[model samples]
Target: MTEFLGSVWWMIVSLGLLVTIHEFGHYWVARRCGIKVLRFSVGFGKPLWSRRDRHGTEFAIAAIPLGGYVKMLDEREVEVHPHERGQAFNHKTVWQRIAVVAAGPLANLLLCMLLLWAMFVIGKQDYSATVGRATGMAQAAGLQGGERIVSVDGRSVATVGEASMALTAAAMDRHDVTLQVVDAQERQHQRVLPLSQLPAGFDERRVAPLAGINWQFWLQPALVDRLVDDSAVRGVLQPGDLIVAVDGERIDAADQVYPAVQALGKRGGPGMIDLLRGGERLALEVTPRQGLDGNRQPVWQLGIGFSESHAPAYDTVLKYGAFAAVPVAIGETGRMAADSLGMMRRIVTGSASLQNVSGPVTIARVANVSAQRGLDWFLQFLALLSLSLCIINLLPIPVLDGGHLLYYLIELVKGSPLSERAMAAGQFVGLALLAGLMGLAFYNDILGLVTR
Candidate 1:
């Protein structure tokens, strides 16, 4: 219940802030173009708070926090008096109309850069991109555990998030990527991930696992945390003991201990368990109890609690000076924009899954999670969201800012406005497309919740 409230609160805050900035952009541009702005609203529905400016423009905060709008005086929507005809939005020149219509998306673009700049200046904590285990394609490519990823396809990456994004983008295109890695011994090597070999209809969400890469951050050590009351090693082992070897097989990782003990059970004999306890090395003999597992399969049972830790130390910080962060932020935004455009192209070409589309529920949950992480994380999330808003609003679809600009451009080209019938037809089509898009987003969100 607490989590639900947090999600709702954060979603409201995020959407309200972004929508206000967007509407303010339109209002500002419209006023500069000598147009009469009727209202600048942060949300829809009944106004909860409102104040009219000296110019008779009402500034309002409405009940609904989902979206916002800037309503301007337009002759098309309402009859203008002779004295106020020049102030109507529809009376403005096509170029002025274009500028007024384009301002909202431009504001979001600027906001994205500013947010990212602040995020970089504050520094984001992250785990190193080190591989813990390799299998299938990764193993076949000579990738090994304990190697830290240095770069992917010539792009340097320091954290798992960066590596994942680069890899996922390439995977979507079914393109092989080159990797640079440094082993634990500081030996550098080059390898190729044959992403092109991925089977048809592969899951885009499971990029890392599908590529056979397991991160070291998720791999726990071989430390014993708990023992069951009826456990075979209950007398020999205690909590806090680090398992060193089992039956002469080295046990550096927790996963290695299970198979080694199972092999001992298969041999039908007592096995030596070498362990480190209280700075002292000891070897104890323990006989395993063979049993039918949950699936009714014969297996050995150790009965040791091996759950992962709740907290882990962040080993890296992506930070920069205030001035230095500007260029980095710009570059980051450009890269993200390009990647987003590429994803759209892939989706249109049917090369990408529609599951990538997410609705407000997913956004709210992620916003809450990111906010809980730290300020830097939340800023980064906001930056990405802002950039997405800018891109989406700029798409050449009717009823959007880009759509208004499109009509103005066509008017400029043909030396006249579109017929009212044509404009109305376009509005109907736009509303249908927008509704379908919203429905798809909601469906994806619900599907995700149900699956989880």
Candidate 2:
């Protein structure tokens, strides 16, 4: 229950920050354009906290953290006073109104770029796609284990994340995928493998499949970074002691240790844990406690934290100087943008599933996990999330920035605003569409939780 509440808290914080920033953009731009803003709200529904500034704009924090809005004075409303008509939003020039509408998404994009820049400047470690091992079963015939995949089809991959994405793109079509791999002996090999059968309840709309062989690299094991009183890990494993194995199985890599420990069931007591100290292996008992991953899967945990000193064998380290990171950050931002646009195109073409859409739950889990990892990881994730937010808001859907932009474009061409009845109809359609999309996203979230 504590962990669940913690997750909810993190979700609220993340959503609140992003939505506030987004709304601030509109508020700031509207004020700059000599428009009379009535209310600048963070979140939606009834305001939980509000203050009226000297300028007469109500600054508020609403109940729902899902989104926010900037309400402005408009003469189109029946309650508009004659004295306030000059400051109405509808009195603004078409360009000024467009600027106000465009500011929100632009702010999100800028925020993303800044976050990306900060992440690169601070330096975050990432694992390269250098393959360590690839197990061969009858399902994965014609591919040898331990071959490093350099590229899929013709696209060169530098990191594991990129490789995974490439595979997902290729997997959309039911076809054999070609891979370029380097063996341990330094020999490069080209191999073609057929796609494996997918699992049941696998929502293609929600997730893409791997196009090529999925490989795993070794990660450093979790060590005791911090200990809480009465926690299972503190009573068993101490700081400076390396976790060597769980359930008598040899812990070859850090990635395997956690799952191994989690897999151990209680036999009327705490499960046995093997540890390695200064060249000595010791046995200790630890009770497995339930924990949740980003996907909210129930896993066993000893309740200890890990330090950053343990470097895994498969890590291909790259260090960047502060000044040198600028170009890298720019390139990364561009790549992220391109990737996002490509995914959207794929989805529209029916090559990608609509299940790719993630709601607030997924976002929060991702943010929390990234925060746990490190500041750099968290910032990078935030940058990506910001970009996603910007792009999504810019989509030409009603009740969004893109929708308003479309309306402005029509006004520009027609030399007049859209009729009030037409605008109302558009709003109705837009609201319905937004509601339907939200429902689908929430449904997908529930389905994900159930399956996991």
Candidate 3:
């Protein structure tokens, strides 16, 4: 319950901040174009709080927190006084209207860059993209353990997070990617990973794992930190034991222990566990036990818990001075924008799964989790969210800022405004499309929760 409330609160705060900036973009541009703005609202529905500005514009916070709008004086929506006719939005030139409509998304794009700049200045700490283990396709592609990934498809990546983003995007589109990696000898090598070979309908969230790549920072030593109360190996294994081998297969990482034990359990026999304790090598026989996992599924267990203190420390930080970060931020924003657009295209072309569509629930949970991680992480999340808003709003759909811009573009080409009947029809179509999109997003969110 506490987690749920935190998610809701953070979601509201994130959306509120982004929406205000977006609406302010519209309001500022409209005012600059000599349009009389009647209401500057942060949300829809009844106004929860409102105040009249000196210019007679009402500033308000409304009940709904999902979105916001800036209401301007338009001759189509209301009667404008003869003296104020020049300030009416509908009476503005087509070019002026286009600018006003496009400003909201443009504002979000600017906000994204600003947030990324702040994040870079603060520095994002993460693990280096070094390979600790390689199997299947990764091994086939000559990705070796101890090699550090330098770039993916010619785009340099400094951290595991950056590499993952690039790799996932490419994987979604089933595109082959080239990796530049450096070995311990400081020799650089290039390898092509045929992500195009990945099976269709693969889970979007697990691309890295599915690609058979595991990072060094994730490989915990198979050292027993503690044992569960009913541990099957409690008598055979001690807390200070360093597990060396299981069933004759060498065990290097704690993650390797589970699959080894599960195989032992399936064989219906005792397995030999090799360990080193107090400068002595010992081998013990222990039978695997069936236990319920977090999802209540039956799984083999040795019932050993790894220590959090044993986890690898962050080895990389992406930081720059305020002056240096500006260009980096702009470059990063451009890269992100391109990736987002590409993913959208892939989804539309049926190359990507609709499961990638996330709604408010996913946004809220991610926001809260990111905020908890660190200020840099939260800022990065906000930047990404802001970028997404910019791209989504710029899509040519009715009832959106992009839709308005589209209509204005048509007016420009035709030398007159679209008839009210045509505009209304577009609005209805826009609303229906928007509704369907929201429904799909919600459905994906619910499905994710259920599966988790």
TM-score of each: 0.95, 0.72, 0.90
Report the CA-based lDDT of candidate 3 relative to the real structure.
0.91
lDDT of 3 by residue, 281-384 (tens): 99999999998999999998888887767757888899999999999999999988988888898889987788888999999999999998799999999999
Superior candidate under lDDT, 1 versus 2: 1
lDDT of 2 by residue, 202-295 (tens): 4443222222233445444545566656666765677777777787786655566666766684333566678877789889877777767679
Model 2 whole-model lDDT (C-alpha atoms): 0.74
Instruction: Give residue 327's lDDT in candidate 3 (0 to 100).
Output: 100
Ranked by lDDT, top first = 3, 1, 2
lDDT leader: 3
In the range 351-382, model 1's lDDT, one tens digit per residue, is 89998888999999999999999999999899
- 1 versus 2: better TM-score goes to: 1
How large is the C-alpha RMSD of every model relative to the true structure? 1.8, 8.5, 3.2
Q: What TM-score should be assigned to candidate 3?
A: 0.90
Candidate 2 vs. true structure, TM-score: 0.72
